[model samples]
Target: MKITTIGLGYIGLPTSIMFATSNHQVLGVDANANVIDTLNNGYIHIEEEGLQKLYNNALKAQNFKASLTPDYSDAFIIAVPTPNNDDAQKSCDLSYVKSAVRSILPYLQAGNLVIIESTIAPRTTEDVISPMIEATGFTIGEDIYLAHCPERVLPGNIAYELVHNPRIIGGVTEACTKAVKELYLTLVKGELIESSASEAELSKLMENTFRDVNIALANELAKIGTDLNINALKVIEMANRHPRVNLHAPGPGVGGHCLAVDPYFVAAASPHLSPLIQTARKINTSMPAFVVNSVERLMASAPNKKITVFGLTYKGNIDDTRESPAKEISLMLQHAGFDVTEYDPHANKNEIMIEQACEDSSLLLVLTDHSEFTTIPETATDRMSRAHILDTKMIVKNCGDNVKLLNLGNMHQSLNKIVQEV
Candidate 1:
């Protein structure tokens, strides 16, 4: 199949490469000429595990090619960015989607399948995208096909997840769904569920919203545990043993592109309709402020303290900082009149203000559970003036009795209680 993928960023490039490597002719279209040139040379702009190998092989095989302009193809996949607007509203910002649809309309012909792999609000496929294409005098489902197939790949493990994760295909019509499903069957090993375009859009939103709400519950419980002078970490651990009760760990804040933003799309579409989802978003969004307050309290305990924040990425093992809670916390601390330094092994040195080494600091805050941060020795802690620690992800287990460890999550309370009792 000849596939034309629009917007070759994080999602587009990987998906295009996957199809190309699978022996499909893929023409990747991006507005940026440099990105197209880079891909044509078998180079990737974004960092992901094992992407370079697939890109090189696909380029060598001549199955993958990139262009600055859209062209005619059997299938048109829209994988552009659908970021929320400044009002915290979930608007599709359809400019990019519209532009892509317009650009391809001139080249679109009958029997062409148009699949949207970008994360968007429900009804976008039917109400927004389909109409834009139909304006070109091409009938959908008969002359052309339209479907919504949201991408579920993680940034660090995108290459693997692109092929491993289950996919949801929501079509304008049943035939459209089957056509998109067959195309996905070429690369995806996971099951493909079919639904209406709106249902599939809501399904992706629900998946990420569920995670945000659960993590918010953990964060809210951690605050309660802190107020009661109990360890939140150990409490969560005990709660999880109940088998039916599973809780996500609390962090500095909800970060990254999806979980932090997607819920707002649903909430924005129906404000005063989804209270729990809105509340969860509020809780997660306020976590940076919570971490800032905690840091202020720590600084108050030790006058004129120099604080070091470990990790800037949203999660462990990834260099992405698109809405990193750790980075926000660091910035908030600096704004609060405290000396703040940051260190993330995955991040470029220019991205962080502090030196890579964890020396000459009064306190260390472990925001992300990066492997390098988890394995830091007591000797490194010894180098600091004060060994006060804030383990946001609760990755560190033991750090002796002298270290003032602050953990996020209710499970930490029980563990701290046990330590104090000993």
Candidate 2:
């Protein structure tokens, strides 16, 4: 299979490399000349485990190449970003997807399969994407087969998930779906479920939306627990023992690219139809403000306290901060007059500017659960006045007598009793 992948970001690069290593001639198309050049030298622009190995292997095998311009290929996979617009609506900013399709339209030949791996709104393939390709006077379904096969790989684990995750392929026609499935069958180990393009689009949205809603439930419970002076974490733990009841942990809020954003796409299409989804988004969005308020209340007694925020990434282990709650919480705390410091082992780019702030803080707020923060040396802790600790993610285990620990969910019932007595 000769595969051309557009938008060489997190999703595109990995997907293209996966196919190329499988012996397919893969050409990655990106508008960034620097990214294309870097890949050509067997270097990867984005960070992911096992990606450098795959990139190097594909480059050495001469099975993979990247270009700023699109070229004709047997198949084209679109894996562009579909970020939500500013209107508080779930509309995708489809500029990149549109540009990729337009660039490839000139070279698209008959029997070429165009699979969209980008997360998009339902009917985007059949209605928006296909018409754009057909405008080039190419016959639809006969000359070019269009389908939506949404990519579900997590950022840090892209290589593993790319091959392991079950894929959903929805095509304009049954043949289109089958062809896309066969192409993935060569590389993907998981089953490829067939459906209409719209259904597959909705399915991806639904999966992420389900997570967002569940996380929102956890977030809501965390807020109520905070007010009641109860440990939300212990409560959730007790509930989970029922086997049928499983509750997600609450943090500053929902972060990461997919869960924070995808539900909006579905909500935008049918706003009146899905109130639960909309409410979940609203609750998650409000979490930063809630965290800020909690920090302010803590700061009231300890006036002008220096607060050190440990972890800036959206989640634990991964460096990505896209729509991260930790970032938002840090910013909110900063605005509220507390000096804030941040550290994430995975974040080497100094993207969040918290190193200087962390060194001089009076309080330590564990916003993210990055592994590095868990093992802070006693020597380092001694330099910071042994500041009070707020464990947002509940990553910290035992706190010494000098450090007062505050957690989103009350882990110790004694703490709740103390709060009640106070």
Candidate 3:
């Protein structure tokens, strides 16, 4: 089967390559000419585990090609971005998704399956996409099958999760669901659960919102623990020992496109009914300031205000920095009159090396839990004015006796020590 996937981004590129390598002809369409040119030359613009090699194999099979425009194919997958609006409600913006669908309208044929893999607001398939396609003189379920299949994969392990994760396919009609299911069965090893399009849309948003709320609880616990002279991480470790209680770890703040943004979509859909979600978002969003205050407290114990940040990506071992807390923390620190330098080994062309960033710095702030951050270079610590570290993600290790470690669990102790000295 010939497939056309629009928006050759993190998800679209991998899905296109998977289909191409699986013996289906694929045409990847992106608005960026640079991305198209890069892929045509057998180079991917994004980094994922084992994607480059798979892309090369797909190129060798002569099954996949990328272009600036769409082509006629048996299936069309719209995997474009759905960013949040600038309004107070922060609703999901469907401009890119709508544009991608409109681009394929001219090439769409009867019996062609259209799949929306982008995360969207509920009833988008029925209200927005159906009306658009119906205007083109084709019945949605009868002429062109439509389904909402949101992407559920991690960044570092996207290539593996894309194939192994359980998938949800919600269609306009029952026939539409089955038609799209056959295409996914080629690659998805996990169970394919079918439902209405609205169900799938809400399911995806809730999955991320659930994590956001739980993380907010953990962050709240951290604040309370600090007030009562207790360790939040230790509390979580003990609480999670119960068979049914599973708590998420608190960090500087929630980041990435999904967890930090999806809850707002739900809140926008129904402002009054989603107070818990709204409150959770408020808590998570305020974390950067909390971290900034923590930095100031840590700095009180240090000899100087020069601070070096370890990681910037939303999570560990990836190049994506969309809505990263590290960026927010760095900005807040600078605005508060502290000289800050960030260093991430996984980041593309980091501004400075670890040793250089640590030069004359008094505090080392570890934001993202990259494995490389587990062990700091002994030489890097030699340059610090005062060797003190704050591990927000709680993954740092292998520091000698000279370097003092501070984390969520022991921050109260550090604060108490500072008071005693005063």
Candidate 4:
């Protein structure tokens, strides 16, 4: 089957690649000419494990191509971004999604399937999108099979998860659900659960919101532990021994397109009923400031105000920095009159030379938990002028006896010792 996937972004590109490898002809459409050019030249613009090789497979099979506009196909997948609107309620902005559907209207035909894979506010498929297609002189369920099929996959392992992860197919009508399920069976090895379109939308948002709220709890625990001079990580480790207690780890802040943005979509739908989610967002958003304040306390008596930040992406091993707290913290630190050097190995053109980044720096700050950050090079630790580190991600264990190691578990103890004999 010939498939057209609009918006060749992180999700769209991968989904397109998967379809291409699954014996389906695919046309990836994006607004960016650079992305289209890159894909046409047998290259990808985003970072993901094993995506490039799979894209290579698609190119070899002669099954996939990218373009600046849509094409006539058996199925149209709208995987565009649904960013938050700048309103007081911070509702989901469907401009990109709407534009994508409109672009494919000229190519629409009877019996073709339309799938919305972007995370959206609940009822969007039934209310917002259904009307747009209906206006084009096609009944949603009868003429064009419409469904919401949200992608549930991780960044680093997206290609693997694409095949293994369970997919939720929520259609406007029961016939719509069956049509989408038959199409996606080519790629998904995991179960395909069926539901209404709005149910699928809310399910995707809630999946991320659940993580956001649990992370907020963990962040609150970190703050309480620091104030009380207790180890939050230790508490979490012990508490999680209970079968029902599965606590998340706190970070500089929540980032990425999903976790940080999806909760607002949910809360926006019903502001009064989503106090817990709103409060969780507040706690997660304030974490960058908390990290900056902790840095100020630790660096109060340092000889220099130079800090080397190890990572920038929301999580590790990806080039995505959509709403990164590292960027926010870097700005705050610079505004506060501190010299900051950022070294993101994944995003940067150069490789990670930890010793080079730490040279002449007052302290090293590890933000993301990339696998390469598990142990610092011995030379890197010796190069720090103050020989101190504050690993907010808690990925590093020991930076040797000469360098002071401060994690979320022990920042309080060192904060008390102002004149830390570095």
Candidate 5:
């Protein structure tokens, strides 16, 4: 099959390479010239495990080529971003998806299968995409086909998960579903569950929404622990021993394109019945400020107010920082008149080295759970005016006895003691 994948982003680039390597001719179209040039020159612009090698193989086989515009193909896949609109509700913004669809309208021929792999709000494929494609004067099911097959893969292990993860193939018509299934079977190693486009869209949002809500529960627990002098981590550990309990770990906040953003799409689509979802968003969103308060409490009487922060990416071991809470915390700390320096080895760029970031700093804030952050260098703390380490992820272990280590659990213990003394 010949495929034209629009939007050469984290999802699009990998999907294009996957199809190209699977013995299908692929033309990857993107608005960014740098992305096209980078792909054509046998390199990748995004960070993902084993993608560059796969891209190299596709290039060697002459199956994949990057272009600035679309070409005629048997299938057209839209994997663009559907970010939140800058409104009060933060509803789904489909401008990129709509543009991608319009860009390929000029090349649509009979029997061409149109698939939207972008995560959208429910009914968007049936209501928005169908109308746009029908505007091209083609009957959707008879002359053309439309489906919403959302990508279900993690960022770091996209290549592996893309093949292994079960996919939802939601088509406009029953015939459309069958036609789309035939195309995906060639590449998808996992099972393809058939459904309507709206179901598939809502399913993807709910998958992330479920996680976000659970995380909010954990964050709320952390706040309660802070006030009540309890160890939130210990509470989670004990609760998980029960047969049916599996609570997520509390962190500074939830981030990334999916977990933090997808729930808003759901709530905006149905505001009245989504009170739990809305409350979860508010709880998670407030975590950055909560972390800032923790920092202020711990570093109140330090000789110097200089703070060194480690980790910037949303989670650990990746370079994607689309909506990371660490960035918000850093900004908040600065806005509150604290001299701060951030260092993340995994990030594309860092202004200061880990050693320099720690120099003369009174406090160290650990946000992301990178494996390298499991132990802190003793020499890094030698020059600190005050050696206090506040570890939110609970991963920093070996800072030595010279430094005062604090986790979310022990923070309240000290605060309560201070209150008793006062």
Candidate 6:
């Protein structure tokens, strides 16, 4: 299949490369001329595990190309970002999706499969996108096929997941479903489930919402533990020893494009019935502030206000920082009048060395669970005036006894005492 995939960000670029390397001709389209230029010049803009090499393979195969505009192709995939729109409803801004679909309309031919890989709210494929495709005077299911095929791959492991993961193809019509399925047979190795477009949209949103809710529960427990002077992490560990009780760990807050944002789509679709979902968002959103307050409380007796922040990406080992609470927390600490130095080592262009970031700092704040964060260098720790570490992600195992370490696991025991002393 000759596929024209629109929008070449994290998801779009990798997906374009995936199809291009899978024995399909792929023309990746993006509004950013720089991205198009970069991709066409034998380089990719985003970071993924093996995407650069995979893209290089696609380039070698002479099947992948990039452009600023869409062209006629056997299949068209829209993989754009649907960011949050309104404050009251928290619905998605579908302007990018709409624009991408409109751009491909000029090149749509009969039997061409149109797939939306962007995660959307329920009924968007049927009610919203179907009408836009129909505007081109091509009847869906007959002249053109449409389906909502949301990508279900982790960022770091996209190449493996895209081929192995079971894909949900939500078609506007039965013919649409079957046609889209045939298009995906080029690459997908996992089972392709057929369903209506609305189900697929809701399924994708709920997949992230379910995790958001559980994570909110864990965050709430962490808050309550501080109030009651309990070790929330130990309690969760003991509870998970049971056969069915698997609780999530609490952190500074939830981030990333999915977990922190997707639940709002469900809540916006039906706000009256989504009280739990709405509340979960609030709890997770509140966590960054909770972390800031905890920081202020612990730093009451510090010699200086200088602090070092380790990691800013949403999760570890990736440079994607969309909706990152670590960044938000860093800003919050700065707003509270603290000297802050952020060092990701992996991300932030390796801006500041660990030793430089920690120089004369009173506290070291660990956000993302980067593998490199397992042990802090003795050189960096020696530079801190009063070495104290706050591991919100709970990944730091060794900082030495010279540095006082506090995490969610043992925060409660010292929280109230710290508050009293402050």
Indicate whether candidate 2 or candidate 3 has the larger TM-score: 3
Cα lDDT computed for each candidate against the true fold? 0.83, 0.82, 0.92, 0.93, 0.92, 0.91
Where is model 3 poorest over a 10-residue stretch in terms of lDDT? 345-354
Q: Can you write out model 2's per-residue Cα lDDT over 1-422, one digit (the tens) per residue?
A: 89999989878988999999999999998888999889887699876888899888898899998888878899999988888887868577778788878878888888899999888887899899989988888766677889999888777788999899999889888888887888999999988899999999999989999999999999999988877767788899999999799999887888876899899998899888989999999999998898787776665545356887788888887768888988988888878777776677676564454434445556678888876666545444554654567788888775555666778875334344545666
Tens digits of per-residue lDDT, candidate 3, 108-219, equal 8999999999989888999999899989999988999999999899998988888899999999999999999999999899889999999999999999999999999999
Best by lDDT: 4
**Model 2 — TM-score against the truth?**
0.93
Q: Point out the worst 10-residue segment of candidate 2 by lDDT.
A: 410-419
- The candidates, ranked best first by lDDT, are 4, 3, 5, 6, 1, 2
Query: Candidate 4, after superposition: displacement of residue 198 in Å?
Result: 0.4
Lowest lDDT block of 10, candidate 4: 413-422
Q: Which stretches of model 4 miss by more than 4 angstroms?
A: 419-422
Scanning candidate 5 in windows of ten residues, the lowest lDDT window is 346-355
The digit string of per-residue lDDT tens for model 1 on 1-422 reads 99999999889999999999999999999999899888777688877789999999998899988898888899999988877776756555667887888888888989999999888887999999888888888887888889999988777898899898999989999988988889999999998999999999999988999999999999898888877777677788899999799988878889887999889888988888989999998999899998777666555546346888888888888778888888888888888777777778777645533333456777788988877765557766776777778788878776666677766644345444554665
Residue pairs clashing in model 6 are: none
Candidate 4: residue 147 Cα off by (Å): 0.4
Residue-level lDDT of model 5, residues 305-324, one tens digit each, is 89998888898888888899
Clashing pairs in 2: 90-264, 231-410, 232-409, 232-410, 306-362, 341-357, 341-358
> What's the C-alpha lDDT at position 17 in model 3?
95
For model 4, how does the per-residue alpha-carbon lDDT over 198-316 read when each residue is reduced to its tens digit? Answer: 99999999999999999999999999999898999999999999999999998899999999999999999999999999999999999999999999988888889999998888899
